[model samples]
Target: MTRSSIRTSLLALCAAAVCTVASAKLPAPSPEAAAKAAEAAAKAAWAGKVDNYKLCLSQDKVAAHYRKTTPSANPAAAGGAACADPGPFAYTPPAAKPAEAAGAHSPPGTASSPPSTQVPAAAAAPASKS
Candidate 1:
């Protein structure tokens, strides 16, 4: 190689070594920074999922509408109007009894009292037997 080329190569090697040493001396990312990065990644992923869901639901609605307006329209051509599931996390219970419903609406730290009833003494049973 020419003298100039050799000189340039050596300079390049020295620059790379300097950069490596400088980077190695740098501190690692803080916990807060790492958490923010993770959160950003999650949000991006969630946004993508939401976009897909919206597109799917819209397609179904269009298909259903077309099928409704034109009964004779081809089934393959008309996408069904069924919406994508929101999720299985929601729930509904059977109608609560009056007593149970009332308790559910009460504030916490306020426990209801048990039913009051009278009971005979233990000796009462033996007295009755005799």
Candidate 2:
């Protein structure tokens, strides 16, 4: 087992492991799990917005401090867009409709209406001579 051969063997093993991992299929998440994941994603997005807002505020503060301390040739040109603040984090999960309310099935006790009596257009049309 020379050094080069051992390194080659290790590389091959690593490649095989990577390929195996890449091809693996994870089981689908349950409904509850999916809902949680969605909520987590929303929270993460809100967190990102909050982070950006904080960064913007810090940058603005820094810029203001720099302007106050340093004399610039043009003082009037210091105007820039105001920093936007992401006020708060609010995650409202989408309202779930009950099976009946979602129109999954006809209302509880009511009988289904009879089939339509009108003939379909295709069948009613006159046949072509050709």
Candidate 3:
């Protein structure tokens, strides 16, 4: 390469480096500049799709599912329980017994087990040594 070309290349590289450093040290863009940049970006983003931007965005999101990382399982997180091999409803209704079967059915005129007498015999008993 000629001396002039070599010097030109070095000058170009130096200018680029100076601009990069200066830009890094510069204050953040003003609100107006930021808004302008955002407007420009948005225009560029949906350049052709002024009407069908929503459809385009939805399609892009669907395509991006393949590129997205699978979320890692968190031990502490609660997850919905779904039956992989669902059979019949797992919940069985409580076995229905007639009130008469459990014990003598209280007459309609009387109240059922009074609150004071509601304690079971085992619970009413004092704690026993094993």
Candidate 4:
């Protein structure tokens, strides 16, 4: 390559490096930016708790099982157990999966065959000693 072209490339690289360093030296976030970030973090934390709350509510059987097993001494187990799910809240039931049709269960040619009910003679005998 020509000397002029090499010089131009080196200058371009130096400019990019300077720009990156200047950006890295930027001042800390403004008060408004900090406040906005704090608010967003609070919302995220609340969302996580809300999700866990919903999960706890949906796990009625788990809560019941814990309540059944947990002793009366350690009372903290009641969070996901006895009565700490959610209260006075609207609950939307989960959507149901579509059921497979009865005809789709077996191949057409084998659908009418009777199932084998007899045990094999070898399997019927107990294992012999070596």
Candidate 5:
């Protein structure tokens, strides 16, 4: 093969290898890891909100300054929506239900009954004729 063809083949092979590695399934996160991930995600979301709030406040201040300095033919509207302040970062982890409360093993009211109440198949059958 020509040098260009060889390079193209190698590049295609490398691309395929990268795609295979990227598509490979990742192992499920442990419960603790999952909880930490959830908390991190919550924190990131709150941080984004805080950033947006700060941006809004800064924009309002700039607008007010501009209005004071510049004379306009027509005054801007008197009222607009106020900038919301995201007070604090607080994340409350969801409560975990106890195993008993989860009711995974059996439905409600069945726990009082015995383990097995049905008679054996052979015993329940009538005796065969001679």
Candidate 6:
């Protein structure tokens, strides 16, 4: 093949690959489809916290956690949107939730306070018959 022909073929391959990748990504959904998807995502995200989501304008606590952790770049309030934070390590001892609160248990001797509603009782046996 001539040099020009080879260059053209390589360019065409690159263009085709780009188009294929772009098409695989999400496209502009129709209004109805977009609304349906938004509704589904909202339902799934807020699953059991519809009331809190409505009241706070966000259903996910992950965003709140991020807001608290990151510092804001803009002078204005983030309006519930998350800003960047230096990190928990910036604090003297790092004010993080206790291991039990995060559902993590330490070794037997190193165990901290137990979580609320944690029952340490052993399984009860059936009552003896007369």
Against the hidden true structure, what lDDT does model 2 obtain?
Answer: 0.84
User: lDDT tens digits, residues 14-57, model 1?
Assistant: 99999998888667789678666766776676676677788997
lDDT of 4 by residue, 44-127 (tens): 766776788777666866666776787763556555444243333343333434444445555656556457648876787868
What would the per-residue lDDT of candidate 5 be over residues 82-105, giving only the tens digit for each residue?
A: 878887989999998888789976
Model 4 stretches astray by more than 4 angstroms: 1-23, 61-130
Where model 5 places Cα greater than 4 Å from the true spot, the runs are 73-76, 100-130
Once fitted onto the true fold, the runs of candidate 1 whose alpha carbons sit more than 4 angstroms away are: 1-28, 75-130
Q: What is the C-alpha RMSD of each candidate to the true structure, in Å?
A: 20.0, 6.8, 29.1, 27.7, 7.7, 23.8
User: Which has the greatest TM-score?
Assistant: 5
Full-model lDDT, candidate 3: 0.61
Best by lDDT: 5
Query: Which should have the higher lDDT, number 2 or number 6?
Result: 2
Judge candidate 4 at residue 101 and give its lDDT.
45
Number of clashing residue pairs, candidate 6: 5
Q: For model 5, what is the alpha-carbon lDDT of residue 57?
A: 87
lDDT value, residue 71 of candidate 5: 83
lDDT of 2 at 81: 80
Q: What's the lDDT of the predicted structure labeled candidate 6?
A: 0.59
Full candidate order by lDDT, most accurate first = 5, 2, 1, 4, 3, 6
Q: How do all models score by TM-score?
A: 0.37, 0.59, 0.23, 0.33, 0.69, 0.21
By summed lDDT, the worst window of 10 consecutive residues in model 5 runs over 70-79
Count residue pairs with overlapping backbones in model 1: 1
Tens digits of per-residue lDDT, candidate 6, 1-130, equal 9999999999999999999988896768996786678667655545545444454544335455666777773424446543232222221222457779766775557547665445534434455679
- TM-score of candidate 2 to 2 decimals: 0.59
Better of 4 and 6 by TM-score: 4
Model 4 Cα shift for residue 103 (angstroms): 80
Cα lDDT for residue 31, model 2? 85
lDDT (CA) per prediction:
0.69, 0.84, 0.61, 0.67, 0.86, 0.59
Q: In lDDT terms, how accurate is model 4?
A: 0.67
All candidates in order of TM-score, best leading = 5, 2, 1, 4, 3, 6
